[model samples]
Target: MDMRLLVGRNVKRIRTARGLTQEELAERSGFSQQYLSDLERGRRNPTIVSLWELAQALGATPVDLITPDDHAD
Candidate 1:
């Protein structure tokens, strides 16, 4: 699977599961909502530090951000 899609799905899944909106997450993560939207659509290639920051904002770990989901296949 494409790593971009994998990470994007993880981000979206986790965010929604936690009842977080893109705007809210953007505010929390210091990223724009548009950026998050692009990311969730697999249009963004995040750096390690960006992933770490996003994970921290989402109350998750960087590993969780990068890990493939069971439904990822």
Candidate 2:
């Protein structure tokens, strides 16, 4: 499985669940809107710092964003 896609979908799901827009998440995560869009589209491979920031912005743990649901352990 592609970790990028997994992370992207998880981030998108969580962000939407929190009623946050891409721009809002970007601002909170200290990234550009375009960058956040790329991440949500699974078009960007984020660095560890970026992943941490994104997780924080979404109020999620890095593992929650990166791990596959079935393989969360």
Task: Write the residue-wise lDDT of candidate 1 on 1-73 in tens digits.
Answer: 7778888999999999999999999999999999999999999999999999999999999999889788677
Q: TM-score of the candidate numbered 2?
A: 0.88
What pairs collide in candidate 1?
none
What are the clash counts of all predictions, listed in order? 0, 0
Local error of candidate 1 at residue 68 (angstroms): 1.2
Estimated TM-score per prediction? Answer: 0.93, 0.88
Minimal lDDT window, size 10, model 2: 64-73
Top TM-score: which candidate number? Answer: 1
How much RMSD separates candidate 1 from the native structure? 1.1
What value does the lDDT take at residue 52 in candidate 2?
87
